[model samples]
Target: MRIYLYLIAGITSALIGWNIGQFFLTDLGLFSSFPELILYPCIAISLAIGMVLNEIFISSPTRPKLCLKKAKFPVLIALGLGLIIGLFSGAIAQILFLPFFGIPAVIVRIVGWLLIGVAVGLAEGLTWRWETVEAGDKKRFLHRLIASIGGAMGASFLAAILFEVVRVFLQEMPKNLRLAEDPIGFSVLGLFLGLTFSLTSSPSYLVALRAGSGFEYVSQIFAQISPESINLSKDYPRIDQSVLTFVSDSSLDRIEEGLSIKLPSKGSFKIGSNNDCHIYIPSLPDHVATIEIKSREAILIPHVLYFNHIAINGEDLKTKKNIVLKHNYLVTFYSILKGENNSENTIIINHEKIFRFVYYNRFFDPQG
Candidate 1:
């Protein structure tokens, strides 16, 4: 269901961007005098910008602080790969339509877009770190290559059919408009290619944080947290106000419908008192805990001075080792001397602040 939403959002944004670009280039005649050198870069950059925009608005919202930093690399990769792929695709199309080969122009055009789609997919795929075992690097490359080729080729064929339909429709119109060329086909091609890349590259598990007990007015879910230090303190400086703002819910409503903050797909996040931690809880000491998440599982490693201060699901983390996180696993960080569990199973920290968390795992099967 979420994947469907992602595809819808990605394709819609691509079509909008493509149409705006088309209006400028075709209708307004902007950059009409530019040579191939300038035009190719413009097209390539446009596609890159679209891709980055989709990721920033959609993917980065899951962890908003890292959005700016995430944009730089994917844009560069897409720009370089788009240019190289365009040249390669153009050369292939030219050869296919040559007198010797005698292939139809339409056939060659489809093939060209097919190749471009594959390259686009590969370019997006390369931006993420794929976790695998046994010949990981080679396997990852081949996986991206094959997935992109298949997905992109399918999209290109679909676009070709749609292009012909629109062409026929325009030819029959009262205005006698003719389909001179495909101005919008590439955009459709880009839309599906982006969707393909997202489907293949999305993480297996999504981790989110709900404001548990310590928070007063914060009942919303935080969808993204900074990878380095996630300060839970309401007064923490440097925190993005947008990230923390959400409609407050009643206590019962919060338990049923509260929003949560999503951590990055892979990172070591610190939860501490000061700004140095990845997550800061105002009442907790410096560096109280660290959450190391990778692939499908998250582990809670305590760093507090007292073992009794923190517990998972009412079990004290006495082994002093990493504890695997589970869904609805309550992790309470409180002062042993002053805190006590209430009727609702929530801990009241130091009689004033209560730092309690209920973990929820998304998309992955429950682990014992």
Candidate 2:
């Protein structure tokens, strides 16, 4: 099953890679937008690269029998073999295509060669030590299919995020001074460039493997975290006066709806639900109202400031005057009072563990 899975991934990704290479070759002179041309290549390449690297580079790093049984270092063997084939094939393609595409011929053919190496590596992993299934099904075809898809998807997301970060940083470079190219914030170009270069990495395969393995749930959680962090509903609402935000079930009507997630790549990371959004208010005004989590036990997540008071079940809960929410390796919960410009914010009874407060800060004011 696993072997069959690997076979399918290799075949599909290679086809995608080939078509993309051809598209770039023929369309170099066309005026069409870049997004249409670039996305496929990036996705295909990233998917294939991730698949290949996982097989050749990471094959026997964990297994013990391979260390003593054959004594042949796998990485060196694979590298030597892959390098030879990659060079020969790359040279042939470039030598032929350069006449038609000119300088771009060299570039596209080199990319094609990389994609070919990916295909070869993926195919080898499927046929050789991959076992297709377990001792019984390890070498089987179905399981391989599931695993291959999972690996590819996971790698894709990581690739996308890494690309996004790089794109944002590069756009700010002083060298990109084409004021006429883009009159706006220059964000679109950053996204495009980042996604393009990132595809060469093939993160989807790596991600797909995780999706099929023990880390599937973790991947799902992280994928959801990125988007939920940007949801508009999570944004701090504009208020005419003091506003209390409670995410608990009873505090809101739609607390349990419309938050399904799809990874567009793997199963373990397929459809899921996640709605924990972190809120950040940089400069709270003096006239602003109090901010509270209002849970029975607030697991004071990291990044909290000025926790001066505490309240519990009832009575003057002998709360401490500290902001450290980490108590004995645990995220402790508590009620708190944070001082603002002239007044202080307070918390009441709750079942949860910890609460946090950001006080109205003005320490540099030497005026007593």
Return the top candidate by lDDT. Answer: 1
The lDDT for every candidate, in the order shown, is 0.55, 0.31
TM-score of each: 0.49, 0.24
Cα lDDT of model 2 overall?
Answer: 0.31
The 10-residue segment of model 2 with minimum total lDDT is 207-216
lDDT of each residue in 31-137, candidate 2, tens digit only: 23323233333333433343443343223335545433322343334434444544454545545564665655424533443443343334333433332111123
Please, what are the lDDT tens digits per residue for candidate 1 over residues 1-368? 54555565545544554565566666888754432223333444455455544544454345545555656777677777767876577567666767998887777767666665655565555554321121134654567557655775676677666766676676776553453334455556555656665666544336755556655443224414443334343453121232222112212222212344446668777776676665555556656788888886889888746445677876666766778898678887764223343544453335234466767665221110
Superposition-based RMSD of candidate 2 using all C-alpha atoms, in angstroms: 21.1
Go through the candidates in order and give the clash count of each: 16, 48
Which number leads on TM-score?
1
TM-score of 1: 0.49
Model 1: how far is 294 from its true place, Å? 21
